[model samples]
Target: MAFLALQKDGTQRAWAAEHLWPDCTPYRAAGNLRSALCHARRACATPVVETIGQSLRLAPTVRVDLHDAYRAGDEVTAGLSPPPGTENGLIEALRQDLLPEWPEDWLVIEREQWDQLRLHVLETLAQQLQATHRFVPALQVALAAVGIDPVRETAHRIVMEVHIAEGNVASAYKCYQNYKDMLERELSISPSQRMRELVEELMPR
Candidate 1:
């Protein structure tokens, strides 16, 4: 819940005991809440979670890397790539899934949201690279998107587009065919007409 609050606003948030301890109302008496807050403060080497007037929040000094990465990914998606020397690191950061080991319901929703955000960042970067005629990196980014979610047709489409733009018509056809087969096998459905037309446009005369 602390994580969720920080993610929502990147600041300390005040939540009533009822909000934080929804399942344990009987145990949320003033003395018990004070003891719990003290224990929380002691559990960490430095002060982290803090209580203020019957509400709880992380200390002002704490900063979370996950939030930073999320903002960076958003910036990249909005056409603000990192400086030249840092592009590789930024791309690697964008590739990571948030809290992959956590099984909590909120974390599950956040994971899916972050995954889609990362996919969008990759697709945007790939398109930017393609516009600059940097075909190799463009293809790599598109391929990474497909690896993250094979069922995402836009990623596969981007891969095929990169291949065709690079004069690899045969590779483009093969990519489309492979995606077509996967869709048919996994979902019992055919690729969309737009995807089929893209391949057709790249077909050798």
Candidate 2:
């Protein structure tokens, strides 16, 4: 239910009413929200919901996986290598999205959040891989991220930049084109000037 709510791109209220209580009438929906929270709390050891008047949110105490992954991504972006023992912890954090098997229509805001975080994790992982001269593996992670969220231009940009830095002009240009085509197809948008210039530099006349 939390994943359903978080997957949507809006406030929590809509998820409570829509996915959580698809059969609920407007008059009884608020009560249903409370019931759902109660049930979720019973099944989990932690507080799942925090009540604040008419709005109910995931409890402040929850340390969500995606949030942890974002932090790990940031650390990687800052060029911090994970210690040998900690690699599993960082990779484990990004290996899955919560409630993958559940399908719920809830919000547009959350989908964007997931996309942004996915892009961050992928780009960070790619950077780390490239730093160690693992070009093929870096591309795999970066490209997989782009596949997961085609509209996220940054994933492709990260791969392209890494390729350029590695002196693989061909790979950089290919990644840039892939990004450009994806953006145009998914969002009807063009690549940013920075992306365009890098790709152009790689292309031979």
Candidate 3:
């Protein structure tokens, strides 16, 4: 179901079955898919999955949280605020990983895709908030990105930017030093020249 949702065009039933049940024989996989589809249909009050002639897809009417988060991310990336009433949950939505509890092998790529997408979106959203002078939420969102990937230089950079925007020079410098040390300890490498330059501007000559 999630695989189908990720695909722009719904996938062929055979392809989905094969991907979802890679270890099973094709015949068994197809049977498993059918059963799962039926179960999904019955479990939902409204349709969650829909079948066409030879393909299956998430129902057009289904409201998926990841999809909503992607739309919100796109809005912020485009410099537009998310629609009214969505502000409260935007951070939480961005914090989520795609189906973390599901241990299916097929989910690996999907999870990575969402992880990268959400990280980009979160960083962008935080920058947008900072640019608008919404410092509190900006720092919160930036820190959320850092929490997701501690070694991600971009996320750390944004954290520093948020601190600087709030007139917290000491905090910003501390953040840079901490990240610099983390990179050395974790990756045995130093921060990039771009990061160093950002921090250099913060230093008094």
- Tens-place lDDT per residue, model 2, 1-205, is 4553353222455546665667777657767766767788799887766666656666666656666666667777677876677665776555556555656554355556665666676677787888788887787777777777767667778778777877878877776777677778878889988778877777678
User: What is the per-residue lDDT of model 1 for residues 3-112, given as tens digits with 9 covering 90 to 100?
Assistant: 53445443222333443344555455444556766777778898877555544666667876666667878888888875688667767877776767765544566778
CA lDDT, candidate 2, residue 158: 77
User: Where is model 1 more than 4 Å wrong at Cα?
Assistant: 1-6, 10-37
Deviation in Å, model 1, residue 173 alpha carbon: 0.9
Cα lDDT, all candidates: 0.75, 0.68, 0.85
**Which ranges in model 2 have alpha carbons more than 4 Å from their true place?**
1-19, 22-27, 33-67, 77-79, 92-101, 165-167, 181-189, 203-205
TM-scores for every predicted model: 0.80, 0.62, 0.90
Clashing pairs in 3: none
Q: How much is the lDDT of residue 114 in candidate 3?
A: 76
lDDT, candidate 2, equals: 0.68
What lDDT would candidate 1 get against the real structure? 0.75
Which digits, one per residue and each the tens of the lDDT, describe model 3 over residues 77-186?
Answer: 77787777877698788887777898988889888877787788888888878888998998888888888889999989988988888889999999999998988998
Q: Name the 10 consecutive residues with the lowest summed lDDT in model 3.
A: 1-10
